[model samples]
Target chain A: MTVHRPQPPEDPDLPERPGPAGTPPRIPEPLSEPLSEPLSRADEAPWRRVHPVSPLIRGWIGLLAVAWFWGQNWFEDIILAVEDPGGRGAPPMEGIPFLGGVAWLLLVGGAVLVLVGLSFFLSWRFTKYQVTDQHVNVNSGVVFRRQRQARIDRVQAIDIVQPLLARIFGLAELKFEVADAGQTAMSLAFLRLGEAKRLRNLILARAAGLRSAPEGTGAPGPGLPGTGFSGTGAAAPGSGVGPSEPAAGAVPATDPAASPDSAASLDPAEAPERVVAAVPVGRLAGSLVCRPLTVATVVLVIGALVLQPVLTEDVSPLVVLPFLLGAAGALWKGFSSGFNFQAAASPDGLRMGYGLLDTRHQTVPPGRVQAVQIRRPLLWRPFGWYRVAVNVAGYGPGGDGGEERSTVLPVGTFADVLGVLSVVLPDPGTARPLELITAGIDGSGDAEGFRTTPRRARGLAPLAWRRQGFALTDTALFARTGVLGRALVIVPHERTQGIALEQGPLARRFGVCDVRLATTAGPVSPRVVQADVEVARVLFLEQADRAARARHRHDRDHWLEENPHG
Target chain B: MPQEPVDPQGIAWTRVSPKYAAVRMAGWAVGTAVTLLVLSVPLVLRLAGIWTWPPLWLAWAVPLAVLALDLVRLSLIPRQVRAIGYAERSEDLLVRRGLLFQRVLVVPYGRMQYVDVAAGPVARALGLCEVRLHTAAADATIEIPGLPAAEGARLRENLTARGQARLAGL
Candidate 1:
């Protein structure tokens, strides 16, 4: 006879303890230090040791993350529990003298969960992070040690992530995104929420090549203990590192690691970072619930529940349907990722992070953001809400989290959109970004120094000919196209990887070609569709010149600079 | 700008050696005849045994469609070959191909990852080759086919030199 079993989503293959952190994930190993490399970083140097509580935040996400790779066996039990309200029945202990098979299995399952949690805890305890002036090193693994070093100078972006449970405990994970495509972003998980913020600031400072002095050591000072940014923690006013602004009021203890000994340290008092744009909690909540995807999901869920008993099949739609339909994941992901969205500009680039469940802190320095796009869906017109996304070099391993990779604005007003876009493309290649954008998109085509597809090409791009076109300025290329829904992609010449012009039978017959400007960052495809062939040729040649010039003009050794804005 | 017809002839088109077209046509003719024979076998047998009305029509339809497609392919060979050409500029390689789409791609020498020339058995028999240019971006590869083997090699060498001189840094 078969025994009944309740399972938690567990992948059979996911190493509860990944044997080698750098393996399957396949993060590119750091290049070996040169033979003539300079002095090694001091072991006692401040910024060498990670905050004490690194394990809690990372392990929390790791446990939840396992549900994905795990066989999803736990899902069936959730459905079974809800499907059958049958009260707990006595186990078949009557047959087997002491205990029933079900009881034993339940005990085993509980024990496994406890064991998994303990392992995550142990893993967190063992993991160590060191941020030197030149590199950020992550070391972990109980039996087999793995150390990952990302050069601070080469850091593409830094993301601080907090999963739902970790957020409750005021913890987060810092991810280092680098320039190498084959290399995986190095993750430093589960630091105290306050400590994560301080660490992010310090790393950015070093990445900017600001090697004035080392900040502080790993241990927290006596005056500022328990500064994890938890609401429960009593944060001393004016605590730890920063320009004195409490990080969204989540300032944990001043980074005990920032500068305990040096009089010149821990105070970025001169480090000028001011909040450029922040979405209100109310607005963020409104955006989540009112999103087109969310509303459709709610409707579908309600329908599924209402149709549950009437369904012909024995399987419940509640649990099974979400697996069958992708929208459910989209709904949860859309709402959870951008909650409490905030964007700030420091001497570096723009720092944006948000998540009710998994908080992500990503910094795109001045020269790295390849492209910026501001889109207003037709449905959003009346509400005056626009969504914005940017593309930065080295935002790796997001597979298809296109929107997640560069979401500067989840939902914001027109003014808010301008505020964010201004940060992304401060020098939007135009003297007047406002007028240029308005004319290009509104189809109010009274030529504000922009052009539309030639009339002959109307046959090729029937619906969008009037609106689709590209404009070249000295610094950037702007392309706008849409029939019902519209998009405007701005790519600075310096950031363009390559540009392509495509034509097919139909396009040739219609005497037009499509020009695509490829950038190394973001998912936006900047294409000028159905342009006159001659026009495309000229644009192609012009773009090559513009790109070469743009590269030299903005040749920045460091991504971060002192002040950013038009 | 004045309107100009999207014509491949306007550019000083580099014609692929006619011998290549002949070899391609012969290969296509044999492939088409084999596919038609395979498809018509059941119809031929069924008609021979049962003398069925449907099989009679089906038999002719297979050959007819095959004939039509083969003839179209034969007629388009020159145009397809003629449509492909590459122009090496001072700083970039300009590749033009396609009869219908009139596609043109300008790959900067700086972005060139590598240049490759492939000659298949049929192409080698006809002394023809295809030059492929690759950039870091995957989809940005430009392949120009049906060039004389000598010309393909020359283009490859030229592009390689330009790429080395202009390769961009990370």
Candidate 2:
């Protein structure tokens, strides 16, 4: 069989159709096709615009400022010590000739100046980005210059993030996710709100054009481009169906000349339409308070306060309370900030916007999603809510290895939960609500079409001591068990990597074994399913075999039919 | 010319190198000793005037406990090694390992991402290297430690080339 190859575009200008009203018009295609041609040379030109150094660099700047302040204090102290030795503790050592005070100021001043200067220089050196007709290019480095470019077609998701300060200034940062390779992502830092939106529209248009392009095109494939911004728009032209489909709708049809103004208005409204669900404030508050990290932080702060007087002897017990209170306030503030979380479905995939103070927007496309996980904490049972997250490739800061993408839904009610899940998994809303299964497990027998396995039933007693596993009727995802301290793991069959049947010497003698399902995120141990060794072995093997087969088939289709660009 | 069967032990049996078991024992011994030595240093320093109390003494207890745990663990390592063995056939690589828990990880040549040959300082001193078979899954990495450096490098090259050939077929 001949390998499919995209035909190269002969004229670069052919792809550069001016968008409505001087805005770059989207290429006329679904936003899922791969680009056939290399990005126009104009797209890669340097000197378009550059980003300030990442906020991480500001930390260095702050450090340098502190050092300068400290140096100044030290200099004054030295002057006093030298000039008045017996006056305080020891007179300033200024009598040590010209080398004492003068030398100190010069040394300290020079060091501080150098540090401040380097911060600015490094920021300038490390932040550079370019927007062109076909792609967004970013080149960053202090010591080793690395270049990353995202073709409009390959752009799977776009995100716009505005820090509180940035929001006040109407400035935002943009991120473009290309594909599976983490290194290929392009980021645009600190653009004016208008400029960022314009850039987003242009990139989205390009992505749509590339998506609609015929297969074997050299362009990047269609998916949600990873945009780090809080908002993303996944707009693609209807695939090959012609304009007739969209034109048949409720909105009035406009001539091509009138389309620009209409499109602009339509574009802004698209953001709201894409939203699947908004996270409830109450549920988010509960989840945050329930987090082990939050609990540990509180415990540590309280312990520090209580022990400070005994340990230090000099520090007052009252001093500890303020510090503890301050820490608690900060935690509460951070949690509250992300309370009104919003998840929206974009043309490319999904965009989740959260956080109150340092608002974060993460964009994930359907294709980049490796797996989905739904977790319900034991305490959350009464509320009928679950936490959902996806395992996507690429490791970012505050991520768990290469597994972290973004939490699509930190905490949401059942309908809101299903709304987000449908974007990631197949047929999510059709599944039964969680309450029925819980009631069934409680022996109310209200659950329909759900039966607990003998192993699961026996396992329930031990599991209830920690947490009981329940099933969502009509969904393949299983809730095996929950513990008070552990996150309630919901493992969908498709995402399970392998199953391990573990038996210790004690357990082996008792004829009970634990079955652990492994995923890319981490190992999820579902406690002793109360089965004989032989049965356990068979179950483990069966699950593992199914997982392996499913993964194989999925990968084959993905590599072959799905990602035509790669 | 006729091709010979690859197994040295013939049908119904497989012979794994005794060196594999020896190397595992050595690793456990060195690991335990180093852990004990590291843990004891803090206690010694605390007895001196160099530092103050709450010197993470509880954290230090973890490694001390680990050292004691390794004694039991060392005894279990052999059975684990015996249960685990690697066999290379024309089509795939089969890795069977586990003790009370057993697993056989099979990787078709086509699915391999890369083969990494690495050695820690201690393993290098023992003239051994580790070969890690990697796939796309971030966490699904399998390592065969304590191979001779030459064999490790050779295996890496062979697997890499074969993996490339298979990828090209796709």
Best candidate per DockQ, number?
1
How close to the true structure is residue A150 of candidate 2, measured as C-alpha lDDT?
A: 58
Candidate 1 TM-score to native: 0.69
lDDT for each residue of candidate 2 in B67-160, tens digit (9 for 90 to 100): 7798889888766665655656554454545655544444556546678888777667677777888754444455666577777788788888
lDDT of 2 by residue, A1-566 (tens): 11112332224333222121113223222111222123334533333333232332324456556666766766676666666654353345434543455576668666765665565546554555665555566666777876766565555456676666556444567767543444427666666554455456445534444322221223222222221222223222223211111211122222234343433332221221255667655656777677665677677778876787578676665655665676677667646455456766554456666655555556654444544556666656677667766655432212221222356766766556556655665332233434432332233111443323244334434544323333432223444443442243444444454344455555545555555554443223333343445455554444444444444444422221354222
Q: Which number leads on lDDT?
A: 1
DockQ of each: 0.36, 0.14
lDDT of each: 0.60, 0.49
Q: Measured with DockQ on alpha carbons, how good is candidate 2?
A: 0.14
Report lDDT (Cα) of residue A14, candidate 1. 33
TM-score of each: 0.69, 0.62
lDDT of each residue in B72-153, candidate 1, tens digit only: 9889977666666666667766666656555566667777767889988888887888888876455568787777888888
